[model samples]
Target: MTRRTMVFLAGFVAVAIFILGSIFYTKPAPDFAQGIGPGGDSVLVRPHSPILGPETANVTVTEFFDPMCETCREFFPLVEEIIGDHQGKVRVVLRYATFHPGSEDAVRILEAARRQNKFESVLFVLLEKQSEWAAHGEPNIARAWELAGEAGLDLPKAKTDALSPEVDRVIQQDLADAKSAGVSKTPTFFVNGKPLLSFGKQQLYDMVLAEVGQ
Candidate 1:
């Protein structure tokens, strides 16, 4: 073939290859929904889940988190900041994924704290002191109860309440719900039922901002 003809043929082949790649290329599918998850209202939030911020807020951010999760401890401050920025337009629902070894005991303590109307206080205090109680190799669960006491929880009652059947039911149901919602790790967050497009502080912020904008 002539040099000019050969060049034209090569260009045509390249274009065809590009078209084929476009047709057959398989990229990882993003699980995030453009709006929110289907049936999110029912799937994401359980009735007894711990809530932060105003219930009347226009947007809901559901977090599937483990009490012992280091990342949960890290992002909590950012979660607070994002909620504050929304100016009463947002609320957070806490769903326990409880993937870590000793996270269940911590979750039970927080649940008992809820009975005393000190859930938020105890939660914050425990999260703040998480490292001391939630060490990697050896968990110090009693330290969590001590923190709960300081957070205004009735210590004796809390210890009993943590083992109540109601608390056990809540923990089990949350685990089931987390699995149903496709949560396989700690700190899985959904804004208005939509999973964060990926894991990052900025990504979470952006996702919440997008929901708020809508």
Candidate 2:
């Protein structure tokens, strides 16, 4: 082939491979069911599982989240809305997966709040203000303390608890659990122990409904 023709052929081949690789990489993996057993050693830290909703609810939606993940923040409101709408019909279980380095501090702060029985409230506020705090050049522990205060947790105690061995164990357990689940991304979720294939709220709702036989 002429030099010009050879160059054109090579470029075309490169483009084809790139396109094929992109398609393969983005394709969803098959839906596989992991039977519901005890949380056991599979998770780094064992959260309050089957977190009680309506005792009669047939479906369980479990979320594995990182506090510093922007996408998780974006999805938080929607998830909360869904839980509210399905009240008594859906059980939502939250698992900490500190995927980002900054997430460690956030996770510890949350666990500290949990020690004070304020975990849910503090976690919600943290998710709401994640952008403001995480965007800062340094991890803002003070801001986290302020949020804890706002959530009705004693700031001093929360700060002290954040450094405690229990909080450290919780963080370590969460990380280990994330690894066991083969989760590498923030906001990973499971509906009835089956992985969610899409990221949108609508997809999440649909999957939950399907599992719930709604």
Candidate 3:
């Protein structure tokens, strides 16, 4: 081949390589909804209502929990202690996820109590004695009603309200919210809009104190 022709061919090859490299090297478009389901950082932005503690507290602790979960039953006291220690400085929100079929009725009953402004007391009693009602065999609503009665709630009304459409909607919304927030496990906690993977009471307290500048 002629030298000029060879040079032109080489230049063309170089330009093609440059163009392809630039196309490949260009940054990809960002996914605005990435990492948001069962395993993602975007789970923290979802909104949930506070179930305990002061509403105006500086630190918001959101717990995605299952009523029939044994681990959640164990963690209840630790959480209660934390709330007691913090007093008005922390807000605790419980997002009920009905992971087990057994949890459905209990969740509905609790939702009903919530309508009557007796949810906190009822929830505390339920969690404290979860093993009794959540044991093997068919769950006993009568036992649950008795527990509610002990908690100063109107057992008959609570039972009726538990079967209402409003309770069903609340449970459905809780499940949908959990899916949107990427929650897969029970007793997942979020502190000030961030997931808490590992931390003890002191660590949690320090983190909250730092956030509050106390």
Candidate 4:
């Protein structure tokens, strides 16, 4: 082939390859209306789920999270900010996944704090000091307990309540629901019953905004 023809052919091949790669590698967004897995609304939100806004909100953001999950900790503030931006229109319901080592103990501690109306406070503390207590290998659950106490939990009472049948029931129910919801990640989020399949800070915010009609 002539030099000019060869150059043109090579450019055409490169463009074709690029287009084919885009089609094959790009992930299509999940269907929002159909939702994911079984149990439907029952698995998305529960009576025992920790809520962060008015119960009557039109938009519900259900998050399946593990306390010891690094990404969960990072996204905590983002979730809170989204709720704050929407005022009473958006609320977040937290369901435990507890996939990390020693995370069940953290879940128990948070549930215990719930009995005293200190769930949010203790949860904040735990996430803030997560690296210290939720470190890999051997987690320092004792330090987590101490942190919960410092976060205004009644140490003696919280320790006892953490192991109660009620707390165990909460853990079991959430795990079952997470499975039913097909949640395989530490921080799976569903906005208005639509799974956040795109999975990004901006994507989550956009999903919530779309549901909020903003």
Index of the highest-TM-score prediction: 1
- Candidate 1 wrongly placed segments (more than 4 Å): 1-41
Model 2 ranges off by over 4 Å: 1-57
Candidate 3 per-residue C-alpha lDDT over 127-150 given as tens digits, one digit per residue, 9 for 90 to 100: 888877877456666677678779
Report the lDDT of model 1 for residue 185: 91
Which residue pairs clash in candidate 1? none
Looking at candidate 1, what is the lDDT of residue 157? 90
Highest-lDDT candidate: 4
| Per-model TM-score versus the true fold | 0.82, 0.74, 0.72, 0.81
- What is the Cα root-mean-square deviation between model 1 and the actual structure? 5.4
lDDT per residue for candidate 1 within 108-203, as digits (tens), equals 998998999999999999899998899986889988888888888999998999999999999999999788777899898888766786799999
What RMSD, rounded to one decimal, does every model reach? 5.4, 6.3, 7.8, 6.7
Expressed as tens digits, the lDDT of each residue in 73-153 for candidate 2 is 888777777678777677666778876767788887887877888888888888787766776456676687688788899
lDDT of 2 at 136: 41
**Candidate 4, position 209, lDDT:** 93
